[model samples]
Target chain A: MQQVFGNKKAIAVFVLPTLILFIVVGFLPIVQSVYYSLLEWDGFGKGKFVGFALYQDLFVNDTYGIKFLNSVWNTFYLAILSVCVQLPFAFFLAHVLARGIKGEKFYRTFFFIPVTISSAVIGLLFLSVLNPNYGVLNIVLDQLGLGSWKHDWLTEDKTALSSIFLPAVWQWVGYYMLLMYAAIKGISEDLFEAAKIDGASGWRMTFSIVIPLIAPIIKVCVIFAVIGSLKFFDLTFIMTNGAPQPATDVPSTLMYNAIFRRNMYGYGSVMAVFMVLECLLVYFALQRLFRSREEEVAR
Target chain B: MISALRTKWSNVVLQFFLIAFAVVQLYPLVWLVLTSFKTNLEITGSNVIGLPSKWMFENYKYVWVGSDLARNFANSLWYTAITVVASGLLASMVSYAVTRMKWKLSKLVLLIIMSGLMIPVHATLLPLFIILRDVHLLNTPWALIVPYTVNAIPTAMFILVGFFSALPRELEEASVVDGCSIYQVFFRIMLPLVKPALVSISIFTFLSAWNELMFANTFINKSSLMTITVAINSLRGLHTTEYGPIAAGMVIATLPTILMYIFLSDKVQKSIVAGAIKG
Candidate 1:
């Protein structure tokens, strides 16, 4: 068995299919995108090579009227909300629920339901609920005498991007909660017992013991949230499709519009390449940031 | 005495808060189901939260027959089934080779596969579209299936690697000493050992493929070839004022996932947690 398994041919036979598929369907596209980004083509009948002009136009010049910089900034705004607001709220719920509360299974299942369903479904659900005239949100607000606060959530430029975050947070809070909850649950009971015997209060135990121990998982959740937000397209696509003049445009949706709608394939590939690089850079930067903080804590 | 009393009061308050949050989390789904049963007049009327005075079960029938939902549902089912099986088998095989077999480039191979996780779908969309168009696979189910399987390889391999590595080596050694071929050892002996992991990863893969929208939206242009996600999205444009049919469409699109959660919630939750920490 060792001889057969260790044979070079056997290894190639086992691994080559996956590797080749990954390269073709997964890796090759990005390489092709990078290559395409350098050329000037409209996705068909193209043979011109104008190197770096597309990238220059994307950043310095607004020749294409793509709003590329604004889309990047919008993506950053969503990523910040994901890390700052979404994950913390998820962490709070996880910390509370990890206390071995009753109906744990029920609550966990319910919380995660949104995570499992299609984002388009969630987007439509909220779109209907937040509709200005007969939507439930405005109706509820009117009954509570806060009708003045109600606005057209997904249409108006000011509220469209922020309004989408409500559904985004609603969709993913359970996901991060489950992650943190699992990490917290892995902490041994003996530590809590030891702290209790040492007369540590509940808040102290949470602050000094639980939070510190789950710091690594917290970092993982943050990375997930940030990366997920940066590439977010489905909900916004369903809700607004970057309507009302690109107010809710993220890089992914913008890339889609450039490629499919406007037939600007080269420009779209530029956005795609930017997104790939941004994800990698953000991931590495986060790893470094988390590692430095861990070292400081150790010191 | 005062502290204990305070603890009890706080627990009550905490429970109230959690329940309220849960209500907020679940109310939209409940409203969706209720609205699916309401008339268009009821939905757009002033009575927002009231129960339907007369149930409109025909909303479901109309949406089902009026759109390509039934065909899209079949497409989604087959696409997910093929993707889960193909990706699972291929990932497990690679993971098995890397972990159990002797190979010098195993670590490099693993790293390459793992890096696939960071490549966003947006980055690959145009090139893939061009390739599929060139291959005449655009507007075909193969377009979705190929990408789905390829993209799922990393996560499936990530999960399977842990399970494959943790299996005791003694069993493999004994199987070898008994004159079993590598294939026999893998197929007859090792495959059954990782059944639980396979099931968990399959569930994850199924859910991902089921909920996927972008690729389905881009690759398959024909209404008949559309997936449930794209089909439901088209409903938004088709029946803008008809909330009842739209709600019914959502319920249809969401039912499979809801059922999976009901039956396999624990496995699903555990696998998700494991994948997150391990990945």
Candidate 2:
């Protein structure tokens, strides 16, 4: 059995193909992007080495820097809102649903529908809903005697970025809810029974029991939300394409414009490198944050 | 008796809250479907959110024929189908080897594959674009299929590894004792046992490939090669006033997944829960 299982050729056949593909597509590009970020290439001509010059531009050059920072802020804003706003709402929904309400399964399943559909479809759907003239939103606002509230949601800079976030947040509320819901559901019922027998109410049980128990999952959810926001592109790309350019841009839309649209391969690669490092940084930071806290709880 | 009455009243309130939020979650989709069949005039005029006076089934006809939507739909289907198969096969092989095989480097290999999940898709776009271009895969089906399959592999491996790890060692040992070759053991014995994992992984791989837009938009410039998401986005730009057909396009793009979910919600839900727990 050990001989068969350890057959070198069989192991090679099984692992080599996947390993090669993963490295070429999944792993190599990241290394390539880091190398490319240091060059000044238009993706056609010979690349000139300019170590950290583009990075300087990304950080301080007025035109590019301002736009890059704004996009970063926009993404971070979404991250903040996702963690602060969306997760809580999802947790509330999860908490209520986990309490075994009527139609609990139905609600759990239905809420996740937005997540399954493509962001492009959701973006287009919201575009129609937020269209200033014929949009359902403005029309509804008019009917509600709030006509003054109507603005060009996709066009106006003040409203554009936030408008994009609505659909972005809306789509994933169910997702994080489901994650937390599953975690909450996994808690042994005996604990809940004991708490109830001690005369704890639902809210008290949630705070003292559910919240503490599912804290790790909630932390995971936060990392997901933040990382998701950091990389979010499809909806913003679909809805605005950074219409109020620089205002509505996220790092991804900017990276896209730099590479595909403008042929600034080097510049774009810098943005790409920045994003990858940023994601890694945040991921490690969060893991460290969560791990320390878990140790504290254990202590 | 009074406390029981209060509990009943609170349960009603909770039910009401859940129902209300459900409407919020589902109404936009329902509205999109309704708007799909409505005349553009009605959509922009007297019936923004109500039933259309004239249900224009022709809208579907227009989007399907007047553009490359049918071709795009075919491309999306072709890409998604190939991706699902390729990722599932590759992932299963990797999972089986890492879990069952007694190899020294299996741990390192699994770690390498799993780390693929951490790199955001956009982070790799520039280099991937260059790589594809250099290989002359740009504007071809391989451009999207290769990337989509590669992207899905890590998650597919993550899911399949658990299933593969849980299987008893005796099954493989018995198969080997019966004179089955390693390939035979994997193909005949191991593959059939993990069919449920394959199904869940396929559902996930299918959804990502089907809904993918950035790569589809960037890589494929030829109208014939574009996928449904790009086609729908283009329709919105080209036929701005023709809301009916655009809505129809959105519906067509969305219908497969919605219908799929309705049929396989249990598997879909489990797959998602499983995927998220990996983090």
Candidate 3:
């Protein structure tokens, strides 16, 4: 025991692989992104230290500043809309499915199918399906009496970003449901029986009993959702390509296009740095708020 | 009795709603498979709504060759293999070291490792690019391999540490008394035991690398070197967009994941359940 107790070298050996990778890839890049933010470089061109000049470019100029605003707004807008819609729907639907409600296995498997499919595939399918003239959606609307509701969803500035949200929500809801449902399922059945004896209706039982118990899980779920949405990339990129002339841009797409296309790597790094801060702020704030709320509830 | 019948009818209605949802969940993938058989003119002129008239396996063949998805799959397979083995081993090691062993300094080490999960790549892409450039790892497999492995540590370590901590330590201590080294105790003992955790780590790493994009998109600019997701995204740009080849490529791309899911559905479901279990 004494021999093993002081074996720091062996312990370090065990820890070395991951720790080194963390430093090389994870830790260093963060410090480097901030450093790069202070310079002017076009990747191939020489970098000049401008001392926060790129930030000046970000705020003073309409070009970068406005694009950043559109991106941030779209990201959070999608996040808010997703939480409001997906959570309650997944919660209730999970409750319904969890009740040994016939075809239970089928329903569970059914919802989870989309999750195995990648966001890229979902984006591709929607891009094709939401085609303005010949798409399935517009065609169905034209068949109905509400032909006036027909509009170009993906290409329109007003609807493009929001248009991608449905597909994102569709792919994700089941994944979250599986999380929430699994949580609800783990709750003891005696509670449900007790609620029934108290004359609680199904909806009431769900609201009072299941909701409170799963609140912690839901908090984590919402955190995952919000942080994920804040940094969302692939689906938006593929689906809209920031179409309708930059109206649909999210921060990631902005960061990507800035770096890849224009080669304005320095200004792009500033935007990237801000994105990191925004996520940290949102995450810490949510966590702090949730912690306090839990304490209050306990009291 | 009437109320009982009404309740049964409502349950049936709910079942029907769920079945319809299952179909809607499936419709796009169904279309992709069916349309792979359709001709270019068939896809373009006809609505992308239904089954194909003829079964054509050639779309798969053409895409495998023409779009170079076979090469992309090869790249993805290697990426998945390295990431799963290397990351899983490293994460499992740290998990054992921190969780089971009594080390005062390990408390901080564990916290640092777990907190790494909060670091999203978009936050650090610029810096990562510079670091990779400085090391000349840009456009190399090392660029993808190192970062993907690092990014996975927290989640995989979190899962494994929970699992290892829950393990009864009596057997391990007995092995220690029998003059077994830690390596043998882990390999001859705990390694075989944590099969499920290993599976969980491997599958998670496989899926993560298999679906990885942002880094690959930024780093690997070479045509032959792109991973499948990047390859698929670039497929449209590499040539004219032909529905057959695109559908074929998607089919090829999707098969490995589907096969893995089919074989490991129970294990995968268990992992998700385990995720919910701890929370």
Candidate 4:
């Protein structure tokens, strides 16, 4: 203990700056936000203290109630849909590429390029491409004699959600696929050669041998996917601006709107607090579920 | 013979399906590049997928001269480079001490640094804004650069720590014995060994800092201080629209990033695939 404590000077010199910066810039806001949740501050005025009433109203009021519910739904939508839509294809493609499939590098780059672009840019690009009349998608439909398939994808209620969801899936499928590909390569090659000699077919081999061996990575990917799902913004905000009413609002957008646009600092803080808590809940739930699944598979 | 042909046909079908999915993924980007050449009216008119009848490179011309996008791009570039260097070195220093030095407080410091990862950027915005304001950093480069470097420390440290942990102890010990102080050992011996991890963290740090919107939106006020993402978003007012210059601005904002990704494409693929396990 004494010997460990002897290096206090070295430790303090290394750690103090980041610690101090995080304390002032990060932690204090969380504490202040909780405190602000009890007050009525419109960003810049002296106001009365309103304790927990804001919380009660945010939870119970019918006007904001549906919006809040929709926000939660949007979170779940991105989390669940993206994982389901992206993972199966990403895993197979990754497996093929990792095993030195033809043109592997080009395929990987094509998929992963979207991940590098800002979500804001992707949102804008898609908005133009999905424009009801002049958009490229509609043009494609016309060329193919399937004009009926075309719609104002972003603005119309029937297609707005899918429009945003599809773009998110498109931009990121490569990113996750790359991660999966890496994990696949890391798996020992001797195992695969052994499986081939045992007369196991490729399809069965992938499901049982490959999937179970890389389960840990897939678990981490899901956790990362879940958090990303719940907190996504940029696309919905810039693409539609919660347009056609509250059709595409997520919690982050709602929190941002409440704080900046509506000038409801206290109310916004409550939403912000809930968002943090909601993320934790989803994260742990997935972790527990996956961890147990691993144990079950092991047993 | 008929059955054999059927089996061969099935393999081709499966391969084609994978190729089709890859095509769909790459299309939106192809769309982005093509639309940048079309006129505003042309883009907004019929035939979203049709070929541009007349390519007006004017969009690029208008976006470059008409707005503050060029300045914003420069700001993002400057911030990304400065933050990557500052935070990268700072993280390496901290990781060196924590992993090599015999200190109880170093572990505590490591824990605090790691915790910064889970603290959402939004949660930090308000307090950080006030802190920047207090320091007279509002609308200044300090607001963007300082907050960015501070935010990047955790991930930089985490990667570097993981790197330094996996290093053999004998080399570091030999450096210490060769009349090298801790600082010399860190710089001369330990630093050169962790190049891959450092590059990986640096790319991620630079990318996040360059592309972030909320923090830039909240803390920065001067139009001069705007980033590429922020300036592009602000082009249109609440009522009036300016799609032409906006798309142009979007393309300009995109070029640097595309260039960086292209040049470092192999490095990025290597970085992420290397299984950077922590933040």
Interface RMSD of each: 1.2, 1.0, 2.0, 2.9
User: What is the overall TM-score of model 2 with all chains considered together?
Assistant: 0.98
Q: What tens-digit string does per-residue lDDT give for candidate 2 at B7-43? A: 9999988888888888989999999999999987789
Residue pairs clashing, model 3 = none
Instruction: Give the i-RMS of model 2 in Å.
Output: 1.0
Q: What does the lDDT read for residue A27 in candidate 4?
A: 70
Per-candidate DockQ values are 0.81, 0.83, 0.58, 0.50
- Of the candidates numbered 2 and 4, which has the greater TM-score value? 2
- Indicate the worst ten consecutive residues by lDDT in candidate 3 chain B: B270-279
Name the best candidate (by lDDT).
2
Indicate which candidate wins on DockQ: 2
**CA error at residue B208 for candidate 1, angstroms:** 0.8
Please, what are the lDDT tens digits per residue for candidate 3 over residues A124-165?
777766767656677667778778988799877777877888
Worst 10 residues of 4 chain A by lDDT: A1-10
Which pairs clash inside model 1? none
- Sort the candidates on lDDT, descending order: 2, 1, 3, 4
* Candidate 3 accuracy as lDDT: 0.79
Stretches of candidate 1 above 4 Å error?
Answer: none
Evaluated at residue B183, the lDDT of candidate 4 is 63
Superposed on the true interface residues, model 4 gives a C-alpha RMSD in angstroms of 2.9
**Which digits, one per residue and each the tens of the lDDT, describe model 1 over residues B1-279?**
999999889889988988999999999899999999999888987456888888899999989998888888888999999999999889988999999999899999999999887889889999999999999999999999999999888988888999999999999999889988887788899889999989988988998999998999999989999999999888878777778988999999999988998898998998788678753
